[model samples]
Target: MSKKLNMSRRDFLRLTGMSSIAAGVYTIPGVGGVLAQDEREVTIFFWDGPPLIGIREKALAPFDDAYPGCKLNFTSVPGGPASGYNDKLFTSLAAGIPPDVFIIEIGLLPQFLADDLLLDLKPYVDADDYDLSQFPDLAIEAYTHEGGIYGMPDNVASIAIFYNADLFEEAGAMMPTAQWDDPEWTVDDFFSSCEKLTKRDGNRTTQYACDVTGWDKVWQTWVRIFGGQLVDDPFYPTECTLNEAGAVEGLQFYADLRWEHGFAPRPEAMAMGTTALLQTGQLAMFYSGSWAFPNFREVDFNVALGHYPAGPGGRANYVYYYPLVVPKTTEAPECAWNLLKFFNGPAMETIIREGGLQGTSFAEQEKWFVTDPLPPANKHVMLDAARHFVAPDPVLTNFGEITQIMQAQIDLLMIGEERDAKVVCDEIVRQVNPLIKEGQWRSG
Candidate 1:
C-alpha cells in the first residue's frame, strides 16, 4: 500500500508564500504590505541614467494624472560598471525589501527568475486592453519561464554595424547593403573594406580600420555568423560548442584582421578612448549594440548605421531583451501593473525615442526612427538589423556566470593559446555542466 503523501507546515507555508508572490500579492510591512493611509504610493527602484529615467518617468505620468493621489516614488540606484547594480539589487532582495517594479537586464534576468524573486504578471497582462502584438514575440518570450510570465520587456536591443561615413568615403569603399549575405560582398568584403579604411602613420605607428574592440562582444557576433552557439541548449547543461570547428573558424576570422591582416589595433593599444578614435576620424567601422547609439552620436564625426555582415548561415546577428519586471516584494501590485502597462503603451514612444533606446515595440521604434534619422550611412539600417538578430535563449540559468565561463575560454582561443576549437569546447563543458545541474529551476 502507498503511504499518504503529506507536506510539512513549513513546506506548505513556503508554497503559499510563492503562490502569493507569483500572483503579485505579498504580506509585508511598508513595502508590499497593506497601505494604511487613504492615499497610496508605489515605490519603484531602478537604475539611474537618461535611458531608464526617461522611460520610467513617462510611463508613471499618466498613472499619476489618472489616479490623483496615487503617486510614484522613484528611487535612484547606482548605475554603470554593472557590478555595483548587481551587488545592490542582491542585497535588497536578501533583506526582503525589493522594489515594486525593477529593470532586469537579459544577462541577469535568469538569476532572479530562478530564485522566484519576480512576480508572474500574466494575469494583469491578460486583462489589459492593449495591443501586445505591437511588440515582438521574441521580447515577450525572453521573460517567460516554465510556462509562466515573470516580466514585461522595455527594450529589444541588437548588435548592429555603425560606420563612419566620412571615413568610409575617405577609404573609397561603398557602404554595405542588405545582401551582405552574398559571399562576394560579405566576409571578405567586410574585412577588405576595413583594410582599405585602416589608416597608418608614416612610421607605421598606429590608427584604426574598425573599432570592433571588445573581446566577448565580437566573439558573440562571430559565433553566430558561423552557425555555432556558446552552449548546446538553454535548458540542458550537456556540452559547449564554443570550441567547435565552426566557432574556431569564426574566432580565427576575427583574430586574422588583427594578427594576419594588420588592420585592427592591438589589444593593449585599444585601451585608450575608443569612441575618441572614431571621433578623431581614425576608425571607420564600429560594431556594437543599438544601446550605444546615444554614446556614438556624442562624437563629432558623421555616423552611419548598417547590419552586421552575414555569413554562410545567412543574415546572422545577436540581440538582447531588457525586461521591466515587478518583484515579489512589491507593496502595490495593482499600481505597479498599471504603471507597467502605461510604460509599454503610446506614451513610451516619446520616452524611448528621446532617450535613444531601441525598445521592443515596433510602433515606438518607428516613431523614433522617423524623428531621429540614421546619420547618412543608412536611415533604415536599424530595422534591417532587427530582421535577423537572435537573442540568447532565456532557458539558460545564471547567464552571467555562463558568459564568464565562455569568455574565459574564448580568450584562450582569441590569443592563439588554444588552436583546436573542439578542445576548448570540451573543457568548457567539464567546467560549467555541473554548476548548471546543481541549479534550482523554477516551474517553467
Candidate 2:
C-alpha cells in the first residue's frame, strides 16, 4: 500500500496554497468565483483488493489536492460473494444515506439501472461538453442505457492467453503469437500445440498443456468464439440462450479439454492452484484477464501474452470494466462529478502507467499502455482483442443470484458430476429463468 502523509488539514491547505472561500463563491486555479457551494463530504464506495487499494490511493491524490473543501471519504468493501458488497450498498440506500460515488461492474449495471440507483451522467457530460469519444466505444456502450450514460468507465480489460515461453521451448511446441491477424494461430493450432505440450508419467500427470478456471468469464470467451451468447442481448437480456446449439458446442469443447482430452487440468489436479502451476513451469498456457500481468511478471518464468485463438466467430473475446457512478441520493453531486471525472480521466492514465495491470479505455493513452519493461512484451494484443470483445449477458436484476446459479451448474459440469454440456446448460436455464422473471416482476 502507498504510505499516507501525516499532514494536518491546515498545513496541507497552506502547502497547496488553497485558501478558504466565502459562501456562495467558488475558487479554482485560474477561475474566479463561480458556483455557490459549501464544504461537504463525498463518500465513495469501491471494492477492496490487492494492488487496487494502493493504486486507488495514488490515483485519487490529484483530485484530493484539487478539491480540498470537498472531503473525499472512501469505503473499500470486499468484492465477491457478490452479495456482500451489494447488500451494504442497498442497506445504505434504503436508509436514505447513499454513497456519493461508487464503482459498478458492467455485469451488475442492469440491476442497478432497473432499481433507479444511479444518476444519469448524460446531462453532466453535455453541460460540460465532455468528449465521450475519448473512451472506447464498447466501454461507453456498456454503461449506456436507453441513450443515457449512467457511469464513467474506469478500468477496462479483455481476456487473453498467458503462456510460459520456456515451457513451450521445453516441450518443442510452437509459441503462440500476440498478433491478432496471424493466420496460423487458429483454435485448431492451439489445440494441436496443447496436445504436443501435455505430458504424463504413469497415472499421475507431471505437466498440463493448459489451465482454465470454472469462472464464467474465462470460459465465456470460448462460447462467443463459437458464435454463441448466454443471453439474447447483453444490454437488454430477456431470456437464457445457453441451451442453443452453438453455446452447447462451445461448452462441450471446454469440458472435453479436461474429461475427454485430458489436455487441461481439473481444479483438483493442481493442489496449489493454476497460478502456482504456471509459476512452477508445470502449466504451459492459461487463459485469464489482463489483471494477471503483474502476478505473472513476478514469476521466474518468462511470460508472454497471446491472443485468443480464432474460431467460427472470428477471434471473439470477453470485455469487462468498472464504471464510476453517483447514486440518486448524493448530497454533493457536483463534487462527486468532479471526482468521477478525475478518476475516469487523469487517474486512468496514472493507473495504466504505474500499475501495469490493464489499459484504460482512452485511445490517446494507448501509447503509454504498450510501452515499458512489462513482462508481456506484446501487451498490445489485449488492446487489439478489445476490438472484438463481448459483454456479459445482461441479467436485469438479481444478478448475483443468477450468476451463482449458473456458476454452480458450471462447477458441476467441470467436476464430472454432469457429463453433457447441453444438460448442464439446460439445467441452468431452468433454474435461472424463473428467478430472472421474478426479479423483473419485482422491479416492475
Candidate 3:
C-alpha cells in the first residue's frame, strides 16, 4: 500500500484524460453506472472497502443490467462493526435512512433480529419457493429465526488447522490427515507435533510451535470442542456456561499450550503477528478459518489444511458465517431483495472462491474451491467441516457487548496472567450475565 496524497477530483481528471482499466475499459472507474440510469436506485453498503470495488462492481453488473430502472447505488465502507461501518449503520437507522441492503457479521445477527431491524425475507423466499436446500444446513438454520428468514448466506468460512507442511517435514513430526473421522489425529498427536516442531536458541525461542492469541474466535473453539457452550441457550440465554468444568478444561488446555507447555508464543513475544510468524517458518501451525486463505495463498512455503485434532467433543469446528442482509427500512423492498438474490448466485461465488472465502454452503461448487493446484492437496476438509460445523458464539441480543466482557477475561487466561481457567471463566459469567438477562434474544 502507498501513502495517499490528497488531490481534488478535478485535479486528477485534468492530469490525465483517462487511465487504462481492467480488460480494456478506460473510463473513470466508479460503481453502478454500467447501464442506463434509473429513478429507483437501491442504495447498498458493504464493509469490504475501496480495494474490492472492482470485484463488487463486476459482481453486481448483471443486477444493474437486469433492472436498469432500479439502479443499485453502492458504497464500500472499509471496516466491520469495530470500525465506522456499524456506527454509521446505527446512526442511519436512528435517522430512518438506513441503506436498502448492508453487510453484517454473524455475531450481530441476534441483535439486529431482536431489534426488528431486518426484513422478514420469508415472503420473498416463499413467493419464489426458493430451493434453499442447496445451502448448507448451518446457514439455513442460522439465518432463519422464529420462522422468519432475514438474510442469505453470503461469505462463509469454517475454523480448521492450517499447518506449514515444510516445517512439519523438517521437524520429523507426523503429518495430520485431511479426513475428518481419522482416529489417528487427536489432541495428543497435535501436542507431540508442537513439541517436535518447536526450536530453541539459548532459552530464547527462535521458532514457536503454534499460536493461540486468546482472541474471541480461538478460545470459543476450545470451549465448543470440550462439549461446552458459552450460554445456557443461544436465543434466550439466561446464564454463562463457561463456568462449568467442561468449559474450564477446554480453556485450560488452550492456556497451557502457551504458559505451561511453552509450545506456543505469548502475545507480547510475537513482534510480528501470528500470520507473519507462520509465513516466515517461525510458527509451524496456524489455527484459524478459511478466511486466512487469501493471505496464505501467496506465501513461499507450502501450506496445507490439517484435519482439526479430535477433542473431547470429537473434532468440533466453529465457523464464522456472515450474511448479506436487507433492512426492513428499505424504500424499495422488491429491489433490495432482487439485489440480495443476485448475491447468492454464481458470480458472487466466483468472486469469493479465489482464496477469498471457503465453506460457502454450495454443494455443487465443491470442485471449484479445491480444484486449484494450490499447496493444500487436501482441501476437501472444508466440505467435511461444512457438514459438521458448529457456531459456538452465543448469539445474544447484546452480543457485541457480551463478547467484549468475555474476551477481557479469556485474554488473561490465554496469557500467563490468569493461571486458573475457572477464575477467568467465572469472571466472564459474573460480568456478562446481567447484560444477557436484560438483552437475551426475543422473537420479533
Q: Per-prediction RMSD in angstroms?
A: 11.6, 8.3, 9.6
Model 3 Cα lDDT, one tens digit per residue, 1-444: 999899899989866554433323522232222432344578788776533545765777678777656777877667556778888887888888788888887878887887888998999999988878767677768788888989887666666678899999999998777888888878888889989998999898888888877667777777777777888876557788889987888899889988888889988877687878888888998776655666776788888887667888677776666877888867678888888777776456655653255635465447555676765556777667776766635667678888888888887887688899999989988998898887765642
Over 1-444, each residue of candidate 2 has an lDDT whose tens digit, in order, gives 999889999898886664454321343311221242446677788775666656776777778678776767778786632748778877877887778998776666777887787888898899999887766677778778777888886667777788888888887787777887787677788888889889899977778998757978877777776777787776556778889988888888888888888888888877787777888878898877767777766777788888877777677777676787888767677888888877767677767776655655546346664675668657777787776555645646676678889999999878878889999999988998787676552221
List residue ranges in candidate 3 displaced over 4 A.
Answer: 1-39, 353-355
Comparing 1 with 2 on TM-score, the higher-scoring candidate is: 2
Question: Could you tell me the lDDT of residue 24 within candidate 3?
Answer: 39
Q: What TM-score fits each model?
A: 0.82, 0.84, 0.86
Against the reference, the lDDT scores of all candidates come to 0.66, 0.75, 0.75
Rate residue 97 of model 3 by lDDT. Answer: 77
Q: Flag the better candidate by lDDT, 1 or 3.
A: 3
Residue 160 shift from truth in candidate 1, angstroms: 1.3
Estimate candidate 2's alpha-carbon lDDT, on a 0 to 1 scale.
0.75
- Per-residue error for 404 in candidate 3, Å, reads 0.9
Question: If both were scored by TM-score, which would come out higher, candidate 2 or candidate 3?
Answer: 3
Clashing pairs in 2: none
